[model samples]
Target chain A: MNARVTPQDSALIRSARFRKEREADWRRLEDLVEKAEKNGLQNMDFAGTRDLASLYRQATTSLAIAREISLDKALLEYLEALTARAYLSVYAPQERLGGLVGRFITKSAPQAMRRSWFYILLGFLCMGLGALAGYLLYLENASWFYVFMPPEMAGGRGPDSTTAFLRSVIYDDDHSSSGLGAFATYLFSHNTRIAIFVFGLGVFACAPAFLLTFYNGLILGAFYALHVDRGLGWDLGGWLSIHGVTELSAICIACGGGMQLGMAVLFPGRNTRKEALRLAGKDAVKLAIVAAIMLVAAAILEGFFRQTVQDMWTRYLIGWTVGFGWLAWFMLGGRARQ
Target chain B: MRSPAADVRKAQRLARKDRRAERGRAASTILPPEGVPLNLPVASIGVRLAAQIADVLITTVAAVCLVILFSALELTRPQTIMAIAMLLFFVIRVPYYILSELAWNGQTLGKRFLKIKVVAHNGGSLSTHALVLRNLMKEAEIFLPGTLLLTLDQESPVASWIALAWVAMAFAIPLMNPYRQRLGDILAGTHVIHLPQPILLKDLAGEAKPMTAAKPGAKGFAFLAHQLDHYGAFELQTLETLLRAQDKFMSPDVHARNRRTVATIVEKIRQKIGFADPIPPARAVEFLRSFYNAQRAHLEQRQLFGDKRADKHHAADETPQ
Candidate 1:
């Protein structure tokens, strides 16, 4: 009835129907292929859409070519190529500045914006307060300076003259031994941990807050008097300045960490202490990580290089340069990246 | 007509093309072209962004609330830690969906309520593996340079560069064209589709119940109906066309237009029926069949007795001339 449908005839009819239906798919393939050709691919990664895009290109091209002629192996190869090509296009590197800016925002937003003011105020306050305490301690009992100064430096001064001991140790480079260097490194690390803990614990506003700040001040006072008694006060100051700047700054940073923690507990903002502490801990932890990095760098300079460089003038130059350099770095260079 | 042999050769060539075409058609449903002009329903980007923001907000709020609650309760350190741990569970573990996919899903709870869903590379369901992979890959989305590689000179390569790495990773998946699923989805072997909620005639008639069955026969109708109901109107329209093309209710129609018309009519019936609880298509049809059988019995009885039955006989006999 339908034109003497034979097996072959039926097959032919079926084929015709299939071809008619597949026209849209073939056209879509062509469009994707054309788009791929226009936008060539370069770099490829496994995580994104690199392979799918390539295969799409190859498939589209093969379909396009195959549609023109009959099925051919060569045409399939073309399809493969087209697919790879299309996949590669999407995988190619994205725009550069756009990504950097995004990273800058993500990293910098919390640290600088949220905690900057508190750190600045605390750092300056500690320095000024420590210097005043040191002056008072020196004026009260000059020999008491030995309490703050390292035992080796204070003990070296004999009955001949306290000034001689101070000069020989603080101002004089001969006494700066490698053992002392190692000791300083160990002390710095221990002190750093304490500082970090203090800063971390500052949220309570009671014991940790007082202990961390007062300990720093008392140490500076004792060390200042020991040097002043030796009559090499300014010289010792210059020598300490080189690596001390970074080292002390790191301590302040640790305090900032503590302050961050302590504030969370004390103020609690709209949050309860537990919630506030946990929430604050995220940013505070990151700050601590940054502080650790700064501390380590300071340790390297203090332990290995600063101890070895001994000329008072040389030490002063190096100390001031390193100290000022670190100040500039923390205050400005870091902020600019964000 | 042309030579029978020529017709056969032409038919064979055409058949090969048709087979290829069938595969192509299969692939189309798998991955439609991105941003085609067709009124393909997609959840708005704004809605998706909003949903994501809400998820983050909820997560934050929960964390804060738990911490506060613990402090108020004077909970022990371990308990506080546990509360914090639970609050940050998603950030620490399942980062992807909460950040991007959740947003892509929709803007508001209302949109979610509306049953609109989002899919990657045209609307396809994500497989389980893909669900995990996509979420895991979000680490790169946050940390890697998403748009950085654009300005780098092709001549020089940067190591430890995240953007390039991400590109390579994405490219590895769906390389065969048209399927366009990411690697995660490919491994997971799943696709996303709007959950259907189609209403059956019986449902419209207020006599439908949620029936469960294992096979695709009568039970699958509810499944299909549910799938239709979940998709937006546009997706439902496409699905209707496909179903009509592969109609199983009766004999296949030779005319494409007629087949399409029937599908359109069925969809119209579904809209009009408005079932609060949808019934499966097979069961609905089955119910209709039983009703017809009863009607026939009544008519036959009437004919044998005193009533006229000529119209019923004619209607039954008029199948194939």
Candidate 2:
């Protein structure tokens, strides 16, 4: 032993020795992890699972020590990756898709809606007031209809358009299937855009959401007045009944979500604003999801059934059914558990 | 025993300190939260922006492809075609972001490319709702305002100004925040961080080959196993960074800078671990290097024997003898 063993050389020798001692356990852990990755955790028996967990704990400890000792970067990195992968597999949520969707529908959405009922009522009031005001304004002067409905949107349904032309536009089912598909897509996009806008803008203190809700009601009111003036009020009712029940309610629900968000920011109560907002967001998001589902149902009705249904009575029946179905679901859904 | 409330307060205080340290920019270290043992670095603004740019490009390309496919179908109504195209853009494009983030574990293709990932702010697994909400908000935060601004030529003057203001606020929010979080991240309680890069170990002994054999009584310092047990992974990583940085530069100023840094670290480690060895100025780097190797080996050896070490403290609960 003529050669001098400096501290650096000794440290290297010690590290190499450590590697030799632990190499078998590391190799076993690596094999287990590889098998789990390839064939899923179910492939491992109870003992194997336990061993994997124990190995993971040991590897994490090794990582801590390696860091303390300033071990080789490569060794440290290997441990880090292995530990992280194991942690993910062990701790990550493992809900099946069917279960997740079922839970959301059966509990999450309805419960959220119930929690935010106050905001929903307020949204309804806002829309009602706007609709009444619009009806009265349109009754006072026909020109107010133009103010509420844009020319592009009106599609020649302005005050200047004849009653017969308006009637034909509503009753005509002569358009190509492609045209109907395009229209359906367009209406779905437009409604979705507005719903998202109201929901998002609610974060800005709920004013925009309220205003948008009011604006939507005003359009409906003005359109109703136009139909009444043409002596086709029943026809208009039938026309709106098929899809309006679903579409309008969805908008209202989305607006409710917006108001909920706004109120959280404004009030916050005992919690910090961030905490309050986070809590409110959970309920608000569920309301938005419910609103989206309604919109999809509405789009389907308008696209496939609205034009095809010739009898006004059949249309009203379908519309009222959907409207009542939703009402029942909201009021009674998830109430069994409570 | 500390009250639960006191524990909560302590955690909050630590969190605040960590946030403050992150804002300092010059502080290169990150301290994990109470339960989370990993210390991941937050991604830089430049990397985040690059990732966002990549995502935008992908979306645009997808939109263009849809438009071309629709046009080639030779539909009778151009208005109908345009409307359908717009509809597809919203329905498909929005979900693309949500699903990508969810499936890829908080990483979109762009984020993957930049090696950054979104993680829960509270150090929990990401939830589906959080993923959906954040992506949905992207419409309001970036896309809507951006599209409005780009179409300024067609918009009313008042509307154009409002759009401009919205876009400005969206762009500025991330810059002003310590975590560089956009409105979505703030609302969703998520933030992006840089993924740890793979580390390759170089042979430390091979590098020390130039040293001559030790003369009699010229003993190099050796750290006792107990002395090496004080520091943990965090300190080890910090030292590794310093060593790596030393090898990255060749300029005289950089060398001088590295020497100063190494000396400061050596002194800090000595004080921390209570090592009594008087390391000569020239031997400070070498001494730290040797200590690092020895400590790392000792830790690994302990781990194999089913002994665990969490931090500096070798508590009985953490590492049973």
Candidate 3:
């Protein structure tokens, strides 16, 4: 036991003693964190949870103290890792199921929509311009309809189609073998995939978002032009109005959401592109999810109401009501609380 | 391929690659609100790829299972069945990634298997928004390119070239970044890091005994303040590592070599610290272990007064022989 102890040995000895005293708490915290990580914090009792929090705080303070003193690497690293793991466990985002969903409905989604009114308007205007161009081009020359609309997608509907054929295609209510349920689900899922793609690609400077929305509007205008050429335009309008109002708005909102991403990258303002994108993503995702929900609603109307109700006035009434309802919801919903 | 020369060259290349890879394990220093700097070892690109491959396999299996389930449903109409299968193909992968990460605290099944996790770059809680954004970009980064590659041969030359370029860029994004972040991680402000594993060893404060012989009452060497000041925490840790190693389990030949190494280190420390005491051959390790304890205690205690002697290099010119 012959060793030269220095004047500072008391302080070093105190740190060693400190490690010995606090190690048990650290070990307990590690065990609790491991168990909680494996089987969730909810699995732990109230006493255990309180103990975990207290022990975590002690561990963090120990880490801060140990670093300043330049303690042994092992103890220092142990505390660092322990505190990090404990930090993640303690500060985990706690959202109850109903509260999360409720907040999204009443606050997040609508607020997101209102905030990105610029992008939404941009998306709609692009589509509107494309629709106008398509209408004028097809009206000038019948072949312009064929140029804008692909043969496979046109499905035998063209300028040459008779009035009776166009009317039957719209007002028809026969989907027996392939039921409306399957059809609805199919449309919902298909639109969802396109919506997601539009949302994803909008990160690439918004060019694709513009092109896709414009192309979609062109197809819609060409189809409308074909019906108008046969003088069954108003009847076809009723058929489309049943779901088109909600469906088009959804696609536009998806485009807006996508464009939001691109705009963030393009014009980051004061922050870096990544920072702006992350901030924009919070709202963009909300808009996207709400747009998807609208698609689901549109798919329901398309498959059931559009198929069952053949009355033109009733279809227009339902479609306009839905369109106005969405506008009102976007303009007003979730605003009062904030 | 089986020739000895070729195999040797291949082994050399592999060893070199391993060296390069070891250097690539960059650490992200996160200063939490507590103000302690915690170094998180970011996952290497190779491990990340392996995790991705596992995730891709799971997603592919899921897609196939969905196809089978849809087939079993007997939706007789080909069109409806086709639509459902097509939707399931793209839909399953996104939600699989999202739900797993959200459910498991930024760790998917593959990440858990590989012992890596997604962490926020800002050193805070992993946001649900970041998770969704990152996973959503997977569709653009991997799945779309994967879907395109399936029909690359049938596509026109330009389309095929464009598809190949997209595939290359998507893959190269992670490789080009120091943190190995794909476009998704870059945008989402997240990092994938290896889990921290700090194994606190038994402190060698006073545990110095002869390894080969049970020499009781061996001479205890005491280092003076100036002598202990010749080395610092780094040298102390190196000495501790040497002391903690076990030579008993090795063969007689290797055990002799290990003893030689320890003797060499003991002599070096004695020379460096100007210790004149004659340590017996049996107490050579005991001498080294005592010096390690004294040096560690000296370094830590000196640090109390803000004299952080990191290594012997810092002590060379500062203290005269």
**Cα lDDT, all candidates:** 0.46, 0.74, 0.77
Candidate 3 on A1-338: residue-level lDDT in tens?
A: 12344454343454565665566777788988887788878778998899888888888888888886644666777787888788777766555546766888888888888889999999899889888888877888888887878675666888877778778878787866235436536474445556766777798899988887888788788778878888888998899898889888888899999999999989999998878987888888788788878987887787668778889999999999999998888778887754
Q: Write the per-residue lDDT of candidate 1 for residues A1-338, one digit (tens) a residue.
A: 01233353232222233333343443454455444433322222342234345445444544543433321222233333333323323332233435544543355433442456575467547755876786687678766555555454445553235565556665444433343234333433445645544553465553565566656766676666656655667887866776677667667766766576667767888976655765555454445545555676666666566557776688778766776765554455435453
Q: Which numbered prediction scores highest in DockQ against the true structure?
A: 3
Mind giving the per-residue lDDT tens digits that candidate 2 earns over B1-321? 889999999999999998788664532233233232655566777898898899988877887687787678764356566556656666677878987776566788899898788777676777887887778778778888776676577547877777777778887888876677787777687778776643335545334433423434455567888887786655665666666565675799878877887888789888987888678887887687677666766775676676656666556456555
In candidate 1, position B81 carries an lDDT of 53
lDDT of 1 by residue, B1-321 (tens): 799999999999999999866765565342334321112222333443455456556555766675666657764254235424442443333443533333333112432544444344333332222333344333333222332454456545653353466566555444443344443333233223232221111111111122222333543222233322222223322433343344345544555555455455445545643434444543544333222222323433343454433431443554777
Q: Which is better, 2 or 3, measured by TM-score?
A: 3
Candidate ordering by DockQ (highest first): 3, 2, 1
Worst 10 residues of 2 chain B by lDDT: B27-36
Q: Which sections of candidate 2 miss by over 4 Å?
A: A1-52, A63-90, A177-180, A183-185, A188-190, B1-36, B56-77, B147-155, B200-321
For this target, which candidate reaches the highest lDDT against the unseen true structure? 3
Q: By TM-score, is 1 or 3 better? A: 3
Could you tell me the TM-score of candidate 3? 0.85
